[model samples]
Target: MVRPGQIYKISANILKSRLQMTIRASISCNGVEIADVTQPVKEGVPEILNMRV
Candidate 1:
């Protein structure tokens, strides 16, 4: 759950991809978007996505 007057960090890791593609992520709190990120991913590689709100 999300509380008011607090800061949060979100993270995600991508692993074991067979094809290269783009990853898009959106973070929202209480129907309001806080962070939006777009990353390009490669095959057989690991990628980390991080955002702060």
Candidate 2:
């Protein structure tokens, strides 16, 4: 989703495999990392979402 302030909202599906797995989220601009989320996602579950992105 796009907003007026040049802000974008993105969502991703974190797939799970095996008994142990890890997932992360991030945002980048100009080849530089901006946001990073260090969290693991559970299988068959939607990652926690923020509506007011």
Candidate 3:
């Protein structure tokens, strides 16, 4: 779904393994590609913060 004032490309891929599995995702919004992000998989935490909020 496309929202007003928002642009993005969403995709997904899956990897199969014996002891481990991995899912890959790629997202690009408004010509800015978002890749290579590191985060804790168990929580919803913002990597960057805004001081105004």
Report model 2's TM-score to 2 decimal places.
Answer: 0.48
1-53: candidate 3 lDDT, tens digit per residue: 43445444333322333433333344456787544332222123223311110
TM-score-based ranking, best first? 1, 2, 3
Candidate 1 structure quality by residue, lDDT tens digits, 2-30: 55555554444556667778888777877
The candidate maximizing TM-score is: 1
Estimate the overall C-alpha local distance difference test score of candidate 1: 0.66
Which candidate wins on lDDT? 1
Q: How much does candidate 1 score in TM-score?
A: 0.58
Displacement of the residue 10 alpha carbon in candidate 3, Å: 8.5
RMSD of 1: 3.4
Candidate 2 regions exceeding 4 Å error are 1-16, 49-53
Candidate 2 lDDT score relative to the true structure? 0.51
RMSD of every candidate to native, in Å, equals 3.4, 4.2, 9.3
Report how far off residue 17 is in candidate 2 (Å).
Answer: 3.1
